[model samples]
Target: MTKLQAEVRSNSVAKGKDAMVTEDELDNLAYLKAVVKETLRLHMPAPLLVPHLSMADCDIEGYTIPSGTRTIINAWALARDPSYWENAEEFMPERFMDGGSAAAIDYKGSDFLLLPFGTGRRICPGITFAISTIEIMLANLVYLFNWELPVELAEKGIDMTESFGVTVHRAEKLLLVPIVPQD
Candidate 1:
């Protein structure tokens, strides 16, 4: 296990909770989970899901569809729809705080609002492992490092431009300085 995993486990154990995650604990870690969910939402590794051919004719919205029609769901637009989220352009993780909203909904069922790993039986097989790894890594990084913008960059403010290709990356790479903690 990673250091962050150990720390989270230790903290939970110290509080008399089980070492492994419980449903209630998952519920309580809403904010942390929201951050991960939002990141996945905004930066979906695959912007579009694999095309699916309809088995039969269907009507979606006001549009009528024919049988065997190839359909591709745009994960990117769904993540940033203003109808579902306030300040959809901003990276506010707290948008998911309400249990009734898309941010708070569980991923196990037919969750169409946010499908970073896709949905249904065709969803990525590594979803569980990926989520756990990211959570542990983020927890460890935040716990261990004090990140700061450099003097020059801080003066000018950080640039938020993105470069899109096979995968998205910052047009300018993150240059924050990490200050190691004194033990």
Candidate 2:
């Protein structure tokens, strides 16, 4: 979070603002976008996407699938696949920074390597709406205050264990203290 705040502050200063994140600024904030991307990659809201059915019998690797087979694509596994990502278990937003190899990949469903929103015709219809809203909300939250876990909690570290079912989320509530900047 400190890195993200510093990045935003530097951008704002470059644009002649002391420290502010406007909707316009959010549009071009490469680091912010990377953060969001990394978040999605690490913790996809829906780890298991809608099940897809095979139209016809097919051979995948050495396994043969009969026609009309129900297949559930594990998007979470794909995003964290070691073959496609470096330090896959770690949260490194820099992996998606502009000009980086993963920068060209997106959640729009086209990139199988990172399909948080699925892909093809069955892709989430609300992708644009959701992404825009997420960017705005996250930008505002990150820009408005500095946040940290309570000292005791910080020492223990955050519990990143996920409770996977309908959707994937932290196993425990994340308690944090938001320190608002004084005017």
Candidate 3:
């Protein structure tokens, strides 16, 4: 979050402005978009996406899939697959930025590698709503405040363990303090 804070701060200064980030400004924040993409890649809200039922018998990868078969797309594994991603397990947001192999792909389901919001005819209807909400909220959070890990957490580092369920969430509650920005 410190890195994201710095990015937003730098963007604010580079634009020669110090005010709440507007929707138009958010649209042009390339790095912010990359950050959000990396986040979705790492932590897909729905790991197995909506279960898809095969309407007719078909062959995929030499495997015969019968009609009415229930198929679950493991989006989480797809995003983190070593074949598709470099430093797969690391949280380097730049992988989705310029000069990166996966930079062109997005979560719109068209790119099979990253499908946070499923794709195709059955894609999530709230995609635009979800992405915009997240970007605006995050941009404001990182831009308007200085966040710091609690003293003990700062010393010990944060635990990234996740608890799997209908949707993934941190196993342990993240305890961080958000300080009002001095600037």
Worst 10 residues of 3 by lDDT: 10-19
Q: Is candidate 1 or candidate 3 better by lDDT?
A: 3
Candidate 1 residue pairs in backbone clash: none
lDDT by residue for model 1 over 35-153, one digit each (tens)? 78777777777767667788898988989899989888887888788987777788766666684356545545366777777787788888878887777666555455666789889
Name the lDDT value of residue 120 in candidate 3. 87
- What digit string (tens of lDDT, one per residue) describes model 3 on residues 1-183? 777777776676444335676676775677888888888899888888888999999999999999999999899999999987899988888888788777788767788988898888899999888888888889988888788898878988889899998689889998989888655
What ranges in model 2 sit over 4 Å off? 13-20
Model 2, 83-179: lDDT tens digits are 8898898988888876676878877777898999898888999988888788878776777778889998988888889997868889999899998
Candidate 1 Cα lDDT to native: 0.67
Q: Tell how far residue 75 is off in model 2, in angstroms.
A: 1.3
TM values, all candidates: 0.73, 0.88, 0.91
Model 1 lDDT at residue 2: 35
Output candidate 1 Cα RMSD: 5.7
